[model samples]
Target: MQIKADSVEEYLAKVPEERKGAFARLRKTIIENLPSGFKECINYGMVGYVIPKSIYPDGYHCDPSLPLPFMSIANQKNFLALYHSGIYADEKLLKWFQQEYPKHVKTKLDMGKSCIRFKNVKNIPYELIAALCQKMSPEDFIAIYETNLQKK
Candidate 1:
């Protein structure tokens, strides 16, 4: 579905009816657990929780215009995509997440370098995801991201 949202509210409004509850819960979880300095918005047709562009003027590596330290949640044709900017690149965090959210890890969720794809929101371990978000400060997140970039 093409999204017409440029902000959080509009993004939520465009979400198909069947996915509203799941997306709403996801948004709430993210907001409740978000670290300081992160901003939420609708970007690239999805719900994006980001470290505002003011913090990292360069944005993400692939798209310099977009902000950094961001994660995006989207409802795809058959799955929910949880895009993590740092998780896929950090071996330590990946291992930690696996141990922290065993059920989700065991589900054989589709994972790219930083994207975790699941068939439905129910498959997501919201508590674990929230905990992960809460554990890191904005600075810590940026540091980790930078460290990973240097290694590449």
Candidate 2:
């Protein structure tokens, strides 16, 4: 079902009962480990953690008005999506995560340009995910994302 949430609370409210706990756990982990200046909001039908327009005035692609999220969490019909802005492209980070969190890696983890998809939240590696989030700085993320955008 399509979510109509305009805020984080509303988004959580719309999540199905079975996935509520998982979503809550993921949300808490993200919030507790999130970098400074980043704010959480619901965008693109997902719960996005972003470095507000003020800090990254240029936004994701230098677009002043955009939120330019660094990561996002969403409960999908068949899976939960962990959208990591540039983690897919950063081999170092990917390798680190894979090595550090073998259990999560063994699960159904789908790697994409900027997203990691899992069948359920229980399969997620909270420690590794948090570490990955903690390792990269906002500026580091912006640079990588911008570089990739230029290459395309």
Candidate 3:
């Protein structure tokens, strides 16, 4: 489930062996499509891709010491989870993901405003996931996050 690890490598090591393959594949996709300025680290006990303070200075709005998060992927107890904060904050992006997920993922998607839970990890729609990863830049994500903060 929510295993604690200080680094991405440790987090991967802690994941159950059976799920490692799926995690590895997903991790590869995340790396392959992740935006240039986003750095990968372990956050919230999961793999998090973030825009570090070096680029965004202000860091994460929730915690200034941490980087601004773009996305995260985790191996849960009974399922895997992928979170897209950018998509959740934008209606059009969220709609696109909602529309495409069903077409790509053969299994029923268990999704929320920001989180996509995959109980059947092996068949995740990686192509869609990669596209989602590539949809925005760190700067764009920062702009959106700041805009949303203004609304609240």
Candidate 4:
């Protein structure tokens, strides 16, 4: 399901035409609501918002050459997927999202930790996703990341 694309536009072009709009909407929502200091780029073969090396010199622990990831979206084989560290790293945020999902989303919440899957356009929880995107600024994310590393 991973297609290597040089840019976000290139990645979007590779998506199935029927799913393009949903992915685009998802991407737009992330970018629009993304907190300051996170930059959008192609990471892990998907559209990603990350902390640039200029800000986080250590880079991603998994791949230091790449920037630290915060959020990302991609069109998968059967469903569009969203990955969010803000939701994954924070139990409170995850719980709040779970509690609010039924209030805002009519579709079943098919997710694993931070990965939220959407099979239909109407089922995409834009508000919930945006709220997560806005919950943490780059500074907040860095602080959490550093704290986690210390505990390890």
Using lDDT as the measure, the top candidate is: 3
Candidate 3 local lDDT, 1-152, one digit each (tens)? 59899999899989898889999999999899987999999887889998988999998878899988889999888888999899888888998988998889778779888999888877789999999888999988888899999999
Q: By how many angstroms RMSD does model 3 differ from the true structure?
A: 0.9
Give the C-alpha lDDT of model 1. Answer: 0.77
Identify the runs in model 4 with alpha carbons over 4 angstroms from their true place. Answer: none
Candidate 2 local accuracy as lDDT? Answer: 0.78
Residue 50: error of model 2 in Å? 1.3
How far residue 139's Cα lies from its native spot in candidate 2, in Å, is 1.9
TM-score of 3: 0.96
Model 4, 30-71: lDDT tens digits are 889987899999988888899999999999998898899998
Off by over 4 Å in 1: 103-106
lDDT-better candidate, 1 vs 3? 3
Off by over 4 Å in 2: 62-64, 103-108, 150-152
- Cα lDDT for residue 27, candidate 3: 91
- State the lDDT of candidate 1 residue by residue for 60-95, as single tens digits: 887888888467888777777778765765677777
lDDT of 4 at 71: 87
**Consecutive 10-residue window with the lowest summed lDDT within model 3:** 105-114
Model 3 clash count equals 0
Q: If both were scored by TM-score, which would come out higher, candidate 1 or candidate 3?
A: 3
TM-score of 2: 0.87
Tell me which residue pairs clash in candidate 4: none
Which is the winner by lDDT between candidate 2 and candidate 4? 4
